[model samples]
Target: MPDLVPPMLPATGELADATDPARWAVEFGWEGHRCVAYVRRGRVRLLSSTARSVTGSFPELAVLAEQAPPGGLVLDGTVVALDEAGRPSRGPLLRRTATLTPDAALRAEVPIGYVVTDLLWCDGRRVLELPYRRRRAELEKLALAGPAILVPPSFGLDEAELVVRTAEQYGLDGLHLKRLDVPYQPGRRTRNWLRVPLRRRRQVLLAGWVPAPGRPDRIAAVLLALPGPEGPRYVGRVGIGAADADARTILAAPSGPPPSAVPDGVAEHARWLAPGLAAAVEHRGRTAAGRLALPSWRGLVPDDERDDDLLDMPAAGGSQGGGPVSPDPVRDTGTRARDEARSRPRADAGAEARSRADAEPRSRAGADVHSRADAGARSRTGTDARSGAGPAGTDAAPVPAAGPEQPGTWHGPLSRRLEQHFVYNTLNTIASLVRTDPPRARELLLGFADLSRAADRAEEPTIRLDEELAAVRAYLQIEGTRFGARLSAEIDDPAAAGVDPGAAVPPLSVLAAVRRGVQEEIEPVPGGGAVHVRLVTDPGGPSCRIEIRPADAVRDPFVLFSVPLDVPEGL
Candidate 1:
């Protein structure tokens, strides 16, 4: 069969609050392995996301060859096996994908159907650059359908929200939003298409398992983690539900070293497993220690599946709590040329900065240089490098050099930080609100988008005081959503405190302080607590002070960070 490449992957993000139906196409997101079917002379070959041959896994999909147009065509879609009620079944789907060449009996038992979504190659021509609307129209003209083959209908843009609800009601993953005007982008995770997941689920690596309380052979909970630089970094464990028999059996066979460095108590009873075992885990929130909070088993992840989604480890040369931590909806997009050009210089600078940081001693001086290097790299790339989380927009203008009027773009001792746990927990919080309080969920989702936009400017050392306050507000609002009445936060206007609203302060300084306070004061307390952040001009120097403290406490605030009021000459 002719070679067929994997299709474009959608960037994860929420639907834009102000999306125009005319400009977008909405489709129910499928929960299955991405497959691209290549038909040639009535023969068929199916390729997975990693370009591995999966034709034998679903023999029924070969009917697509008979349904194809005169010339062979390449179709992109997901292969899903359905349950009794017709919802996509993750357990059976995993079994089908892992078996590779399932016999006729196995194929019949877990019959998989191909959900054709996009057309890539048609009439011996690659249609990669056609606008989504035109490409979709071309796909529909082929009339590709059969007993095991499907051409799922794309919902109109006006039905985006309705589609999301329907998907949720039917236990589907979520909705995929595609820009009608954009060309099909293959391999690249662009913002032209966006994925909004109604459920808060993650694929986690299975490091080991804890025996059931009374029955030693039975699993109480399975240890979970993501692949780390040295080994699997433990996230948290999930209680094995009745449906997790497959996961239990895999965990029963221990192999390799312990998944991660476990605590003494956990290490005593924890059984280790070989790498490659992973599971779909659903959780509510995260613990203070960054572990998955109350995770439950979903299904086993096939070994052949790529771990791109499971590789949540922090990127090299980044802060412990700093990286691209926003959920899929926060991605930004730009031209391929611009991205490559911008990335090359930043990569070089980042390498040099890392080298300098490594050579320097663990002192404020070293950190100062490191921060400056990071700031320099970010300033150079500017907002053009930002990934699109909403409708694609024009590239943002580069930040002007620091001057008397412009805020200085120089990171100081305080660097921007966004914890990965926060992203996951915030998503879980949004997921929990979807069914019972969708309005609240949408509000929080918009708030999260705002916060993500703010965090995306991590390279900006300073921003308008009002912007910083707004970010702090969004941060607190999402936290409140997650914590409800247990956690309260307030951001008093700097203007009320006699500070200039237009003045610039280090980006994320106030947010980071509030985050720290929430972690230390509210999260640790059983009853939770309140955090208050307000800015005031320093009495001692020409700088603004951000005081983060407990709202009801009498003790002095733990940490006080200052933002310089005056830009240095010739900076």
Candidate 2:
């Protein structure tokens, strides 16, 4: 498999009202290392935001390679370590990542989990053209779960505020809101996704340091500054929340003369340093004098990681609810749009411009021309069955089904054909691994056999209740190996209710419904939950109903479909 590229990132922005839930989805903003993982065949590759390979740093993430669906899969998420309260803690995660080759003892103490938020590729195909909702559906199909990997729940507009509040209450960083219609753009930062933080944090340059009283060798505090209209200006001092070793390191760095004009009271004891080191400072809010209030050191920003915009000072006298004000919204939007447009692939620029120019003239003549061109394109390629033809052309022929058309048949030209090919290739790949890893190979081979048998009999007109349950259980067990404890199911069998094992029902119907219920209703929950399947028979009627529900309520809107079972005539 080819190497997977690093994921596109979102630009930093303030949160705004999301009045339309259908176009937006929100999730918790995890405070940890941003990592993008690629699972190819049975090997895992993890990359940091800077495209640095960190695969050796987190051995726990190897579970992703085993649990990921066959073929190649690429995921974007954060590597977080949870505190006792189950909330993400950045300190522990940092310590773990800092060690390139952690010992077993350190690994046990600071175990990390990957909180997956987006799916970029699956089954050897790049899914960047699909909308976010579709990508999320494909992600859930993988049933990603385990001690090392997790898929967090997402919420709609109505519950977005609640999610943010809940995150704040749980001591989380904040929330991330993404537009559903936007496609993934590699290496580009667009407004399609916005991040909102619960507290104020900024990266400031380390200007100078104050020597400890009566101990010239030791450091008292570090002076931080933000870029001013003329030069770097004193913002505040970081005196707390750092260990003695950290303080010593900052003070020991090469020093030079103080700034041309030092702020009053700071110059008396401050020793200036060369302007290269930077620190991430967290604080309550800015004081009336525009100085940071109660600032504490978070960590040092790597020398290569500086962004000039991040250091730009906010306009003076601009305050929001007594908190540090954000940059001008109007200016920020214009700058962001320009940057995005400039970053777009140059090859697409000409075509995009031509299309935009052609779309401007909406006259009847233009419409007719566009209709003819679209019809010609469809005639050359085959009309899509999923999206019916427009008024300009007649509907094209439907793609042929692999077998007899069934209720659960999928007719997508690309997907249906790829399904069997992908599965066969996966089995062959696993079989080859048997020489080296017999145990895992054995498990995968058994799962492959069971799944193949179930698929072969799926089109049968009818099957026994016990047979259907067996197939469903086998399938769940296979998927469970991938998800670990994240995916779970409890079935109350019909035999427990005294129903005959020989009772006939539509083949694969119950299994289809249960799988759909879990994917749509259960798996999307942020931290994952359980799914319960119950068999309920009507006392007065001839019909039997299967109930499938998740342990947690779904926040996104969904449509439910009912499938009728085929009963033998005159039974």
Candidate 3:
């Protein structure tokens, strides 16, 4: 067997506005860690894109070795951790990746599957020079299917839009387009193979670290910057757990020059680091100022591995584009509880936010459902609570316009960054329901569509309390579907049933807290969990209170301020 080598990489590219069906083929871009599998003599070895061995991280994939035909074989694909709904999820996969040799308990908790998309070598013959279509043909002939291995079909260019829709429905990363006639070039990011992401993700250079508020000795978040013609351009910071090994790494690195023109209110106590540190960060989109909104740290990687070519890549048709008004995640804004959550494992807001606000943005169509216009212009057409359009009179509440300083105003997007896995899991859950309970599936599907619009809406910093509640309800509905009998949710919003549902509240205010409850309180419980939401209207102002029941000694009921003064900061 030959020594392992870096796998071929796809260059960032836009889907061709016009394409010949015979020349292009598309595959769903699985949102998991990429790997190359080499199977020989009933043994399998996995290598990451950096050519680092990671076989121990995914013992479940060893089934490939047993299924391999006579002679060794080399395959390239992604190693995905499927959630309960059997959707490819990055969080579980990251957990596995963080620990190269996870214990059996962890392994059972996060079983993974190998999604083989390319065949590099088979029957002891190298196929790197073969055209992609031929290589795929050879790969399919192997009939690679197992408990943990799969070979998904590719679509013709004519089906690209359909494929994109399917990927969006299932919360996939995006689509990978390959030139049917081109040969696989090892370790090259070429235009012949294009990567179109459904959401924004990039390798951000770590500029430095910042101390958690009131804790000078502890590292909280890492400042982010991007290489530019002038110099390193300051983007924003992404919060990290103080105890994370990554935090220690940032603290130990020597100081480098500060990024050009660090934004005010930031960089006050930032400790700059020399260049070379980088992280895989994902966000809903860029703010009006080009700063990342809801940036979530995926993991740390060597700066040299940063894909400079992928920077500035334009979104393809049907892709989710970033909005202009979302707040930057680097700001210090939220409650101390949220800050502490940011310091835990999977510390980003996505997980803390029930992965609803944390999950990937919906399709362009879902985003367009709600225009950025004020509450009045954002009404839904249907009255049915379960309808995809969402509850009737979605914008029926007449809200007094308030400035950002108003106590009741809720500004900014969700508290956490959007992740890809939750979206996939939600879709998988909905898909499974289509057969077992079609009506329930339909309701959840519509509810998800409603939540997607809320998640992707490019709105003013403040949204109507009703809209926020609607998004929260949609998320609960989806979670209910995922957990089924294990979870139950109830919303007592008498204020919404009456008038004034349009009271302006910060975006993702209640949702973020609910997400925290579901993630920390509900999801972890063995017998399942319950979420109870109550809306109380008093003279002070209308307050939204969410309670995640079956709490432990450590966790209390989640409570939202009657009127949140500001959006939670630092996703």
The predictions' CA RMSDs to the true structure, in order, are 23.4, 27.8, 17.6
Candidates' lDDT values, in order?
0.57, 0.55, 0.59
Give TM per candidate: 0.38, 0.39, 0.41
- Candidate 3 to native Cα RMSD, angstroms: 17.6
Residue 84 C-alpha lDDT in model 2: 30
What does candidate 3 score on TM?
0.41
Q: Write the per-residue lDDT of candidate 3 for residues 1-571, one digit (tens) a residue.
A: 5677577888887787327788998777787889998898679999989988999998877788777778789999988875433346666678899997889888766767787888888887889789998998888778675556667656667766655544554445568889999888888878888888765555677788888789976877789987653457788888865335566566666677888869867777888877656667776444436577678876665322334221222211221122111122222111112233332222111223222221211221122223313432221111211122212223212121223233222222122122224454565455444436766755765676555545533232444555677778888888876677878888777444443554445455566557655654567777666777666543333345454554344543433112321222331
Q: Who is ahead in TM-score, 1 or 3?
A: 3
**Candidate 2's residue-wise lDDT over 1-571, tens digit each?**
3475657777666557455788988776887888889887678889988989999998878888777667778898888875432446666677898888989988767667787888888887888778998887777667675446667666566666555444443445568888888888778887788776655455677788888899987778888886643457788788734455456556566665565446778899898876656666666444546577778776665433333233222221211113222222112110221233332221111223223212222222223233336433112112221123311233322322122223224323222323323342333344344445656655554554444434434433344555566656755665565456777777667558655444444445555545544444456655455544444443221222333333455432121212222232333
- Per-residue alpha-carbon lDDT of candidate 1 for residues 1-571, written as tens digits (9 for 90 to 100): 2475647888888877327888887776877888888887678898888898888888887787777666788888998876433456566788888876888788756777788888888877778678988888888677565456666656557657655544544445578888888887778888888887665455677788888777777887788886543447788877767754464456445466775557788888887776656566665333436476567676665433323333223222211112121122211121111223331211111223223222221222223233436433111112111121111132322211222222223222112122423553565455445546767766775666556545534444344556667778888898887687888776777558765555544456556556655665456556677665644333332333333344444433332233343322222
Arrange candidates by lDDT, descending: 3, 1, 2
Minimal lDDT window, size 10, model 2: 328-337
Candidate 1 has an lDDT of 0.57
Output the better candidate (1/3) by lDDT.
3
Q: In candidate 3, what residue range of length 10 has the lowest lDDT sum?
A: 317-326
